[model samples]
Target: MKIAVIGTGNVGGALARKWARAGHRVTLGVRNTTEFKGKELLDEKNISVAEIEEAVKKSDVILIAAVPQATADIVKLMGNVSGKVIIDAMNSVRTKPDGFNNSFEALKALATSAEIVKCFNSVGFNVMADTNFNETIADMYTAGTSERAKEVAKQLSIDAGFENCYNFGGDDKVALLEQFALSWINLAMMQGQGREMIFKLIKR
Candidate 1:
């Protein structure tokens, strides 16, 4: 799969590396080609850097891990995204997009041509970097109305080393998913429980 990562921060960098190692073509979309948050990612095999518009044009899927407030601007830069899947990994914890409560809402409204889903926002970037704990891989959760987008997100989560990507339901559950991410943030950062811990589901 050719994936365009809109943000080269910790979360974006970690997932890019994982997918590159998994044999996927990962293009890092950045405002500046020479300097970005995760410039080192260019060293990884199957990973390269491109200007935002070009990157989006070359990829079939897009993973947005940018700041919540920058959602509108980012979507504007992504040319035409019809028939493409967009996986939003951003959360509105500290701030939100201009006219929306969360990144997912902003993307849904602005990136009208794309299939959007929310995933990879509930866990820390460290957890994303290494999903294994005592030989058990962590589980990921996603929510969106587009089944196509959800399926793409699930496969990308698996490519990033997660054990499974659970569907948390449809578009209405998007806000709830962000709240779930807040719960993880509260536990890991506020409660001092550490970022190494992760979430998984078990059934009989």
Candidate 2:
């Protein structure tokens, strides 16, 4: 899949590297192509850099791992996103978009032409880099109204080395998913459990 990653920070950088290493063509979409957060990603095979609009113009999947407050600006630079799958990898627990509850809600309103979903926001970048844990692998979760978008996210999650990407229901569940991410934050940061921990769904 041709993917445009909007942010080059930890989460974005980690996922971009994983996707590129997995053979997916990845474009690091940033304000300045010459200097960005993950410029070293250019050294990786199958990864390149481009300005935001240009990157969005050339990719099939647009992954936004940017700050929640930048969601509106980023969507404006996405050009025409009709039929494009947009995975929102942001959390608004601390800071939200200018006029929306969260980045996902903002994207759903501003980028009406795109299939948007919430994912990759629940775990630390360390886990995203390496999902392996002896006999078990980590699981991912997604929430969105678009089935197509969710499926695309699931595939990308697996490509990034996850055990599974489970559906956490539809659009109504988006906020719930964010809170779920907070559960991880509370345990990892507040409770001193450490960032290396991950979530997994077990079946009987």
The sequence of per-residue lDDT tens digits that candidate 2 reaches over residues 25-87 is 999999988878988889998999999999998999999999999988898887889999999
Least accurate 10 contiguous residues by lDDT in model 2: 32-41
Query: How many collisions between residues are there in candidate 1?
Result: 0
Candidate 1 per-residue lDDT, tens place, 30-100, comes to 99999899998988989999999999999999999999999999988989999999999998989999878
Candidate 2: clashing pairs of residues: none
Regions more than 4 Å wrong, model 2: none
Candidate 2 backbone overlaps, count: 0
lDDT of each: 0.94, 0.93
Q: Each model's TM-score?
A: 0.98, 0.98
Model 2: how far residue 67 lies from native, Å: 0.3
